[model samples]
Target: MQLKIVLAVLGIVGGSAIALAQTMQSNHGDGMDHVTHGQDKPADAFGLTEPGQGAFAALSEVVRFLEADPETAWSRVDLTGLRAHLVDMDRLITDTVVSETELPDGISALATGDIETRATLRRMVPAHAAQLMRDGRWAVEVSVLENGMELRVTSDDPAVVARIKGLGFFGLMASQDHHRKHHLMMARGNDVHAH
Candidate 1:
């Protein structure tokens, strides 16, 4: 029984990874496919919420600068450094897999596998995304319950949830959500609930 359980977990994880890779490959060359959604449109104003320093703060600042003055942002911001930050984000996304023991007390112990950080991010974006962009310390916790994988965004900031509902889901947040979700969901599919 133990062996069977382990095998099943491996299968699900493996399948999710394969699916994610295929999805990314399909969307890679299509440039305009991203724009039709209008998610990348520039914001004319900056956020009023007080932000603390971290990845989120940096991202929010850069986004404000970009939207307020795209010409200057294009000229002043370090595009290469931004790309490196994204690469770091990629690593953070994949590494966020949770373990079975981390589940709550009542959840059935039978189901076991990653919650796939990228997957949940697609269906429902983290409200504290700006903070996440600034610091990878925060994570979306996924618990392997018997019924399904429970997904929740866990952040140190108490204001994250409320702030997410506001008008700040801009460029950094958009790119992180789309790209990360594309990778996580395509691979995981609805793998979270499978027995």
Candidate 2:
């Protein structure tokens, strides 16, 4: 519909805005590097290096096991990695807040002109989400307890999710296809941006 197009355009423009701010940082993973951390955000967890490398690395084995056993995919995966993987993203999003009183400890320089903290993050969301999409790994958490593994697509931060979804890369993984190791599962949102 027209609405989708308008949002898409706005998302593109928002990305441009970040570029204009010159605050967009690049830290792409070469797909081959399984255990490395982004220079932007260093490894604060186990010696795992990359935030969720262990979880993503486990996907191939999980898929192979699933292919071998028709019904054991959910049971065979080392659920710890996937759960821990999503948790890392959750922590990152939670730590990202747009507050007038508090600028994120190390990101103030990324601010555009004289904008306030919230406005700066709002302007930066599109670019940040895109960057996160490129580097942040996601998965469909499946298990034997019920029938599937589900994450609350919508994060606690609506604004951040909206920006991510607006980028069209949202919902990158809302399916059961385990063939590909990385699922670009998106953060859900009620997008309200207009072109």
Candidate 3:
């Protein structure tokens, strides 16, 4: 028992030391000396806080929120669904190709990818288009194509049109501030895309 306890303590201390070293190295590049910036406490007290990787960080945040809330329904939670959605996001970002064209009112884009990527685009693009249309900012339409998907966005205002063209396909897909809330809702077993 004593040997196990000693090993556990050493493991934690070693992990903390690694985190502190990584934090100091990262902050060094930004011209911030983490060591001298503190007068009251040692720099080792501050360490890397992020849980690493974009998707993992997002899921960590959701789990933290759920743990803090008393009303979280543990039985209804669907973290697997959220993980699948994050995988889809990754595929969308890395595997797709987009071709854009200037339109009189806005812009048109054709997005194509391999077999798996095309399936991801088909699932995500129309759902995102629905979310964008709810704001009434632009007329968004998504058409399923054999090769991939087609997205056309239009607005009567020239400024909004220019903004649409500037944003192109990826920007428009990522435009909404709704993703975090959607993730939380989906984790709680709510059908976020149903509406």
Q: What TM-score does each of the candidates earn?
A: 0.21, 0.20, 0.75
Off by over 4 Å in 2: 1-68, 71-76, 98-195
lDDT of predicted model 3: 0.89
Clashing pairs in 1: 16-187, 20-187, 55-134, 55-135, 56-130, 56-134
Local accuracy of candidate 2 as per-residue lDDT tens digits, 1-195: 999999999999999997766543334334334455354554443345333464455444444445566545343344444444444434333443322211221111121222232332343333233333343332111111121111222233455445334432222322223313432121111122210
Clash count of each predicted structure: 6, 1, 0
**Predicted structure with the largest lDDT when compared to the true one:** 3
Q: After superposition, how far is residue 27 of candidate 2 from its true place, in Å?
A: 57
Candidate 3's error at 154, in angstroms?
0.7
User: For model 1, how does the per-residue alpha-carbon lDDT over 1-195 read when each residue is reduced to its tens digit?
Assistant: 999999999999999999898788866545546645346554433334546644455455555545665345244345344434444454334444432222221111122224454443433333334334454533444344443344343345545443433312222244344443332222222222111
Maximum-TM-score candidate: 3
Flag regions of model 3 displaced more than 4 Å: 1-49
lDDT of 2 at 192: 20
Residue-level lDDT for 158 in candidate 3: 91
